[model samples]
Target: MLAKFRQIKTSYFKLLLLACLGFFLVSLTLLFIPLYISFQNSIVKSVSSHSLKTLSQTSYSVEFMQESANTVAEQLFFNSTINQLLYALDYNDIDTIISLNTLNSYVKSTLFIESVYIYSSKTGNVSFSSKTNGSGFEHIDDFYDSDYLKTLKANESSRFIPFPRITSNDKLVYSFLLPSSRSSDLMFSNSIMINISAKWLENTYKSIGNQQDDMILIIDSNGVVVNQNAYAPVLADLKEDPMIVRILNERVNEGYFLSSMDGEKQLVTYTSSPETGWSFVLLTPYSTILGSFANLKTIIFAIYFSIMICGIPICLIVTKRLYVPYSVIQNKLVDLEVRYKSNHMVEKQNKLHALLVFPSPFSESQVLQLKAANQFKVRFDQPYSMLLLQIDRFADFCDQYPIRDRALITYCIQNISEEIIGKVVGAESVQIDRNGVCMLFNQTSELQTRLTPLVKEIQQTVRKDLKLSVSVCVAESGHTIADASQIYQTARESILNKFFKGPGCIVYASDETAKKRAGHSEYQPARQKQLTDLIMVGKFEAAKKLLSEMIENLKDAHYDYFSQIILTITLELNNTIQLLEKANELTLPFQFNTFIAKINNMGSVEELLNLFFRLFDEMDAQLELKKKSKNEKLVQEIIGIIQRDYRDVNLSLESIADLVHLSSSHLRRLFKKETGSSIADYISRTRMEQATHLLLSTSLSIANISEQVGYVNSTYFFTLFKKAHGITPAEFRSKYATT
Candidate 1:
């Protein structure tokens, strides 16, 4: 046994295997700890991402409901018949009943609507569907009593705000007062409130939430906590909540935070709805995300323990074989080294994922932590170049392919780009987003010279293989790793503006925009006036064509110059919008702030022009519709007035026109065009119809019936009445009498 022990110790293969085993065991301490932590992080990150996505989907449901409410309100506001009804002093006639039918139609059209109320500023009497009779707010005090309601009333510019509910179970009613449009009548400025089911919203959230312990909250644009859940604290004001303040103050659209709440650790995921400006927040216990790893620790211990148990016999067998398996051992070590590198590369890819798609404001220390954890080969301090690749018309491509096929296409594109970029730039790349893949290369003396052809090569390869067009934007030289973010921004901006260059267009950040035209020049004042004139004329297509040419010419100019041109165009566009607004005497669709936000986001002039084109088209369509609506409404009003006061001798074209604030001549022409009859003829026809009805229904004398039908001259009334009916009123009565 002693001799055997000496032989085992002396065998080089046994010693070599033991040495490798010892190193591997030590690596378990160093590697497995981080690996376990990394795995834990991966799991937590995945769950949190899932929760955020689920919350976003739930928010979409809410947004869709809000959209329905907004659409209903907009339709009601623009309805001329509704306008006329609201303008009337009382709802005590047949017209009032017709208006009621119209209101009920709106309520029935939307499935989610629990109740709808229209509050008249003029009458101070509430007009709402009777379905809400027992639901409170029968009196306006039920709404005006709320503090936020009072605030909304005070602020003319307030958007749709959530009216406070008595409890969490109370349905959500987003209320708003229509701002005074071109119509000077007080009736047109009525308030609107739409109620949706609280149970539905709650259930939708519950279904989206994977965890039973999760809590959801929805706050509207007014910072009012519109949604009530047991887990959420009702804020006196939503701004009072630190999380809300952080979200608002920081100006981040969405993110996650870990906090100590109610003496336990909680993870909060929050996002803002673009459609409604409402904040959706979700709170879940930290243990739900972190404690899932308890079994992972046991599994890791078992793995290490089993490895230790298996190594003893292997070492004993290797001692007997000695040097025979040395080559095999070397090959195995090589394979293990490759696997270790592969693991590290995966970690690096994850870190890069955060940097690209999410672009968090990571500090230097955090970056360094990522560096150490990922073992990234590229140094931030080194001179670098960036290549941003965007698959052109990605939206259209997505619409053409199913999800699984699109995934394959994306995978193929990424693979091809990576392969070509690797060959060209020596292999450094990160897929930051689905359509956007970034390539990083250390700057060489020939880097700038090589960048153009290299980008084209990859672009051509993707096009050839996938039959897709991709636009490449290059940042040929970056000063340092700290500047990488900025370089990426510049490159991204250029690529986003690809609409101006068209599909498969290439842009370089270092070209004329970055280096040339540093000197600024002021455009002539008349230049703006000319652009404004085109807009005022509603020559949207013409204006856009002119703008396209201007942008193309400015390609060689500085980016600042391009921005100035766009700003000028935007300002002039606003001027034209205001002109049309004043002329039409109505609130235009484009709010100034909203317009500014849209313009600010647009990097390319083509994008701005496209937006302008859409808005202009909408304006044309809306204005034309409004015109037809007003014309039809004026005719209806004329007819309604005639029917209501057919016996009044004073009723005439001038009197009806005065009530509608239109000249008699214009009203007559418009009425004739709309109704295929002149005002005089329509009024006479209406009066004659009444006379015939009275003659048939009653034993009233001819003179009294003529007088009742507004004919002071009985002979003239009889003659005209005979001409209209092709017989005397007495004959018509006898011919069609129900009796």
Candidate 2:
């Protein structure tokens, strides 16, 4: 189970599914949070605004009614009949009945008034009219809400005040008390009380505007509910209530707020009537405001939950489908990255090579190449030196190993060199060619002390592991990146000093010995003329002696001058051979071109000296053979004349015999007896030999080549060339030119 859990945790499918689900949830949250906030704010604002507006209208209406009540009270207070009835000390049944009729008439004049009372404090008699009872006179103490008389008498400063009272019919009424006199002794004065039914006020409050579950109240300055539509009792002390407390503390004539009342949230809007000192409070429960939002929220949540329930599987399917291509692309990207890394390394190697081989005082492209190499961490902007390592006896090395082994061997050398050098300094080693590996060393402090030991160690390691030898050429320190190419070239040139230094040696380009022999040449024209003179006069012993001495002398010189010495010698020998052939002087059968070709395969100067000695012996043997045969000499004379005149297209056997001072028939018989072919055949053979050489060696057209080879007809020459080499001249050249 644990393993399975681990597998699931690491699974690509699981990761993708989780990612999709996370994104979906985050998107929903992002969309829902702000939407919820905005919707809630809008709903609250709308409900509060509507409730405030209703409260305002209700307050205005109540204020209007209070003003109307004040107007009625003013008119009633000024009436002489009501004043006479209240101030009269004694009265008959007629007078009392007339005063009751007047009170009844005043009550009937207003729609909100239920009854009116006129009280005479001197007699303690109250005359009252009611909608339910006929007009009558009674003591003020015996009246329903008769305690209001005490409340009215106690307030001296108030000429008129409103009070709530309950009648014997259990109906609510608001009584407005008006004094008949302004004297401070209110008990001695007459007063009037106008009763307004709470039912009428409630109906008026409802008529203005109200909502179901909405509470409306009219609270007086003493924190008592003057009129109650809902939520609180009539005349209840509601100052401690949360909603009422906030409303009262606001100290503003009108305002709205949200509060919690009876464990339910409510929007409370209140307005105060300045004339009545009564605050109109509207308590709207949040349930009413959020009712529509609740339905919308339900629908939205249902849809959202359904989508979330269905989206899991959809996300799974989508993740599966997407993961296929994603996996493939990821794998392809990995492969591309691998290839890119491989190509990047190769590019770095190529750029480093370009920097090493670039000309001095670097060009723009070479500078760019160096900069590119620096990007690869192959920096040359610091002090550095070049080490050129060439596998000694590279020709022999090739003869021993196959191509694969050679590559591995080269790689081994480069790895070992770089690894060892890397310990002490920053270095980059690149295999420049088959036999050469170049290393750039970035640490040059104590230059000689640092490089000498490291270079020797690298040589020792290569020789010990590979059982092969290498010659290392270390160039002088270069101060800047631009000096790398020149320093590398100097190392390359100095490495050739290995021809004298032999294998498994390190040669410094800055060494005094190497510097002294930089441009000095040991071989001279006088030595060549003397060697040629010895070979021409049939003095093989003296010529052999002279050749050995020259080879010995060249061994001590630089390899550059050594090569020049060999070249001059070979050229002189060819001239001497041509001189001998022309004068019929020494008929030495020397293949000089073949001999020159053999020089490259020589591993040592001793081998080269031995090769030259063998050449002299072969020439001596051929000279003795020529001296021994007279008939052979005559046959050779005829052959030589034929060879000399092979380019003369008109030359024949008779022309050849005339040049040799012999008759045609006799010359033909002598050539057949000694050479085994006719003179005419020999001439054709010679011309064909020249034609094949010219075809392979020159780019001239076949017609011009044919003319040079004594064939004026290019077609005949082409046929002969095809027959000789089993291919046409063009085909032969194309086939062998690249090789």
Candidate 3:
């Protein structure tokens, strides 16, 4: 036995098998045992919770129905028409008509109400309204469920309790009785009865119990099954059932228990509603309740055994391949260490970028990795300052260089920054974006006198070496490493307005502006309105001028505010053009979506302004083209109307505009644009020429000639004719109309 044991210990396969078996046993004990125990407990809790939730839902539905019925009853009780009808000793046909209409409206408006009935014991009058029958007056003794009055009188305390009733039409409804007043006059008081739909209640229960073995029911305090999902008849006594007897005897408001019903063990949950004095009960079979959990347990056991059978041999094979001599492993590890150190630079830059750009606390493991790599040669324990170097005219630069050239230029810029800033202080630099590189270094007192000048030097060197200008934004005074990201953000935002400041400029972000940036820019609605109007009128030059003014005004604003203003302008302009397009005035000149995308990719405010001008020019040309084609037809139409209506006395601008279906002001502009004269001038010219012809060709008097020319005031016509031909009408005829 000792020889066999020694051999087993020395054997790799046997030892591997033993280890795998022990690990499987220990893992199953630690993980599956607690999981199974918790699952067992949870199955019971889950079943009870699910059953209770379903019961509560059903109870809530019943309560909602009850409340709806009561609301209808209250409306009838307070109704002035009903009140007037009830108080009158004799019925006015008008009051009865209005009360019936009012009750009909109440019944039709409420979803749960099958009908509404109003009774006056004093006058022995009855009025009822239903969904099927509009409304009518009936004798109190002939009304359906008229005996409910006696029941209401008997139970004076039951103000809004519902009683099940079968109507004369053979429809089952739950009727609620509500008196007009709370005064102790039940014997003679008027009352309103609201009947809730029994089918709707049953449907609510049916929707809750979708499973075949599930049964839900609503029982009143008297143990009558008022509502049920089963085929059993409602209003039947369920108190004889053992489950119901036990639930009532327990007297708890809500609870669940296992019980045998219909010769099958089921989980029964019940909840009592205080509003309606009804208990909602749900019974789900025990097997169905635990069915999913039992399946889950079986799946878990199958997965466990399958892993044990499949994992052992695979693990052994993999371990056998991985096992090697110690010397060879040591040599391979040494080679891997060299390769890891060689490739860790990029990873270090990413880590540094995260530390500076994302303001999150680092873990100890992360800090230790940085310490071990130690490639960037920067320390985070001390205070630091951040700088953002953004390429000036970045869009132009991208257009000028290819991908490789751009990358090379970026590398050169970083190298220059490292050489320049690192000589003065401990520094680390990383390219954070395509056009921007960020640098962090130890803070010094000479931030303003020393570091600022060095940043300017770096900017100049980049411009000189790479022929590309860069704008450098330096953050505020010394800040802790934790606050590096905040300062970096400030610096980054400050450089966004490089178009306002020229290339190769060094700007410092002041603490005050950094805080003030949080404030919003004042929306210039007046200027925006002016801009929109100008664009609509096709005033390209004026719109361009206004855009320049806007850009200038917003030069000192925060980038967020400026970008929002630009977006607002685009949205408002697009909306206006869309409205015109809807009116068939003109189609959109440019694709608005593509225009907006170009605006977003713009590198500077000038680029944005120029793009706006381009859009304006396109829109202006479109408007001009449309105007030229559209105005000529409208103007000729106007001329024809003037010549035809010259004999009429009311040939005015507004009248002609109505004929042409144009606004008076718009017609005036259009005619002037086409004829180079006013509508009034054209009318005068037409009438005066006719007056001249009449004077020359016919033997008509001046007043007759004036009347023939559609002039009601002859004096005004003569004065206008004299003004036109430099003479009176007769003299003009004598001078120019003679043969």
Each prediction's whole-model lDDT (CA): 0.70, 0.76, 0.76
TM-score of each: 0.63, 0.38, 0.42
Identify the candidate with maximal TM-score. 1
- lDDT tens string, model 1, 1-739? 9999778666765567776667667876677788887887677677678878978888888777777777877887777655544455666566666666777777766766766666666665555653444222234556532443453356445456444454223434444445544335543355665666565667777876468888887776556677767655444467766776766665667888777777988888888888777788888888888778889878988887887778667666655665556677899999999999998777777766655455455555666665576455455556767778787767677778877897677767667766765654554567667678787766666755676777788788888888888888877566544566777777876665565566787877766344443654545567567656777776767766766666566665555566777777777777788778878656667877788777765545567677877887888777777688767766776788889988899999898888889999898889888988998888888887788778877889899999999989999987998888789877777788855
For candidate 3, write residues 443-471 as lDDT tens digits.
Answer: 76765468877987898888788888888
Clashing pairs in 1: 182-585, 380-481
lDDT of 2 by residue, 195-260 (tens): 788888788768766787787878887789877555778878988876677767776688777788
Clash count, one per candidate = 2, 0, 0
Q: TM-score of model 3 relative to the true fold?
A: 0.42
In order of TM-score, best first, we have: 1, 3, 2
Candidate 2 wrongly placed segments (more than 4 Å): 1-337, 360-379, 399-405, 445-447, 512-522, 537-541, 581-589, 628-739
Candidates' RMSD to native: 9.4, 57.9, 20.8
